[model samples]
Target chain A: MDVLSLPFIQHAILAGILASVACGIIGSLVVVNRSVFLAGGIAHAAYGGVGLAFFLSLPPLPCIIGFSLFMALIMAAFTVERRHRMDTFIGVLWAVGMATGIILIDLSPGYNVDLMSFLFGSILTVPVSDIKVMAAVDILIIGAMCGFYKEFLAMSYDMEFARVRGLPVRLFHFLFMALVALAVVMTIRVVGLILVMALFTIAPYLTERFSASLAGMMVTSTIANIVFVFTGLWISYRYNLTSGATIILVAALFFMIFIILSRFASCPRKP
Target chain B: MAPGGDQQTTVLPEGQSRAGEVPDVEIENCSFAFNSVPVLRDVNIRIYHGDFVAIIGPNGGGKTTLVKLMLGLLKPQKGRVRLLGSDPAKSCRRVGYMPQYSTGEKGFPITVMDVALLGRLGLTGIGCRFTREDREAALGALRLVGMEKYMNKRIGDLSGGQIQRTLLARALISNPEVLFLDEPMASIDIDGQSMLFDLLGELNKKMTILFVTHDVGLLSRYIKSIICVNETVYFHHEPKISPDMASLMMGTGEKCPVEMVAHGIPHRVLGRHERD
Candidate 1:
């Protein structure tokens, strides 16, 4: 059977595409808002959600998504709270969040809740319900994005200035994080919690490296995300590889190649 | 000049009487420390309606720190700052602040108009819909800065001068009672500098203005007053009115010395910072 012909392959490809849409749209905001580092911390913090879902004997997707949002809100709130002491506060919270998840998992008996799947991800196992949830997440993320495009644009470019303009910056920031929460929860299946940050940052970074405007960067990022996800999936499935790790490796390779090429390109050209 | 105070009466238009008289800024005995180190010492100043003031000091002289206090971006260890008779920290929406443009990064993708529209954020509620009037006001602010044509242009695409103008527009769009500009003319051409001064002059006719700049001599030409802040704040009442006192007012004490750098301080960066 052709790669696209198999039901699992098709499901994997669809999942990758959906994750990219959510990741790209959300990642575009992350890049502009300079929240990539925060995204990294928040994604890892979602491990507790995975453990909670398995421990509760609840449906993993909904539970994980719910837990991710909870952790994301806390991270978002703390980032603001510790704005002056960001690095230190975020670090402590990061450690605490992951530890809580691990302990909870250890406490839960008998259920071998493939916690490894969360570390590297298992997109091939994405259920129909998970796909629906991802679709809802994509819609919500995109809708919010479109609605606040102007405000988001204002906030991203210059926050203090935005406040001067009478935009509810604090509220917008909260909303932005809410959407990011949605994106993080959605991608938990594709890249797992640990490497999901890459999916959110790399596609946008690539687009930024090439594009001239925010709109250009966003469109290019979405396209790049789709391409990268599919290409990564194709290589992994063809070789019977650990799909999430393979995908991340593919992204990293692209990131390295582009960074090097751009450095040289950005260097002073011969007079 | 006001009788007891050696400063000239801050000029305002006919209808702009001090009636309903909103004091744009009032900082009294404000003190601030950074990580246990004193940055500002017993700072006190009161900026009234339509007063165009410039804040000048050395790099570590706490000029920017003073702006942060006035705008309520930072709080004082002791003392109080009142903007329009309200706490600066709490009344964030009503205050317009243009941060120093020199240290800004360009890689962040945003349009010129987009940056300007940030000023409008204070006007909307949580998820409030912006009416047509809001958009028009934003556009008008952009038009005033002569950046109407480049509304959709990416902020990074603009030159240093244009970025400054864009920031100015952003500050203006909020329709603030008082506008605080930090180093508004940095990294721009002479023309841009003059354009900014001219625009600020126009703005001052309507609202109270407080601008921060490292350049001393030029600031006095336009603003009615100057507050020289180092580790402590000192008021120079009617700076333009008493042109000769620039050096004397700047040289408050033996505390702050003039730093001889390539981009030197315009005045003696004086005053003692209170140690924590």
Candidate 2:
């Protein structure tokens, strides 16, 4: 209980809440659009920005955002133009991005960045500045989602119909990808790139089965994410374990329980 | 039934003749291909206002492709497609489209009302919510499709026929001048199909109806014309399919002539083909 009063623990909790805003809203879009793999690719490729920041002695946040946005554009282009080869393209980019980041960090003279913290996050060490950035990104995400909720819904539901309805489908696709990049970058401080997919997908995937609407799904997923973060943080703090890995494990545990329970619950009602 | 001819044998439906009116949809020498393989070749079609058209073709044929062209979803490599006097893309707001039912996203979370409201996307501006009028219009469209009772239900929970109706409501919510439906009858039962055709017949009085179907047997009495597509497109302005036309549509030329006998309104008997 005393750990909760610590400023660092409080910052970690705030960081988790901010990350969940992005995870819940953007995660719903990503899952519904079936772009989990694409988002994962962006998350990993964001490491290139981390490395570039180290190499150039620049701020990691802006560098990661810029790099991730660039990667998202490329991925979006490939998805829109050549959909058949998108998975392969994402796979290639995912690896190349991580490789570029590692090489850039290696090339940076006399600076040994804690590689494990970037790979698997150090949420406990999150600073106030990073929390401010996450808060700002959350605001931008909420604004975009509010401004274009129907557009995003239409696009995700039936893209061809959306195009016929005069919705700029391709433009929305690019914008959605950019938002995914921002979400992924913010989440890196909480759960890192490797575990980002679990946070982005698991809660949304679970909530999607029961929620009646996209907004409902987002709200439930956000709440579910908050629960996961608080629970995982408590367990990690108690056992002195890795926070990011513990959080992801907690999500995986809930996902398994949900699937099993839903399966059993539906079986009895089936004729 | 010839592939690329301007032969006008159309018997316009009663009380719906617009002889000198500009076509609601016009595709001039439009040829489209995918990966250098032609899907629709030198296709020309002019659908008049208030005409009910059934686009019929095989699975791999260009029926859906032709509809996509009219909707400006795909560009023709060789020619132009115009809807309501402008390019298809420019005139899309006045057009309604119901795409082929896809089971791929069956579990997608959306309500029937929300799906129907999506039709107003063109009218609704960015950062603006759907107004009370928009909700009423969506409800009206759902009522027309007999789905108003299920407006609040999740679209994923609907049956195949119900899903089709919800999608139909979505297309109709915009009050479009021309409506394009791709395989609307795919998963519907015979009774549902008949009821849907009745609804479409009623709608044909207000808007131009062009639908793609693989079931040639379900051609409604309201269908004014039939567009048979393969690699090439053929416009049969009459509902009746002649033996020569049937064979042409079969893609077997004169060797396999098929005979069709009209028995009653919306009923036709296809005589056995003579194969050589």
Each candidate structure's count of clashing pairs: 14, 0
Model 1 DockQ vs. reference: 0.43
Q: In angstroms, how far off is B241's CA in candidate 2?
A: 1.5
RMSD to native for every prediction?
Answer: 6.1, 4.0
TM-score of each: 0.84, 0.93
lDDT of 1 by residue, B1-276 (tens): 112334333322111335566567877788999887999998777678878887777667888888888777677989988877887656767767888885355777766765665566756654555667777887999999899999987766778778888888878887877888888877777666777778888888998888887666455345777776668666755553232233333445554353323233233322222221
Cα RMSD (Å) between model 1 and the true structure?
6.1
TM-score of 2: 0.93
Number of the top-ranking candidate, with lDDT as the measure: 2
**What tier of docking accuracy does candidate 2 attain?**
medium
Query: Which number leads on DockQ?
Result: 2
A116-233, model 1: which lDDT tens digit per residue?
A: 8777888988877788888888888877766777677777776665654456667777777778877887887897887888888888988874565566787788888888788788
Which residue pairs in candidate 2 have backbone atoms (N, alpha carbon, C) closer than 3 angstroms, thus clashing? none
Off by over 4 Å in 2: B1-20, B253-265, B269-276
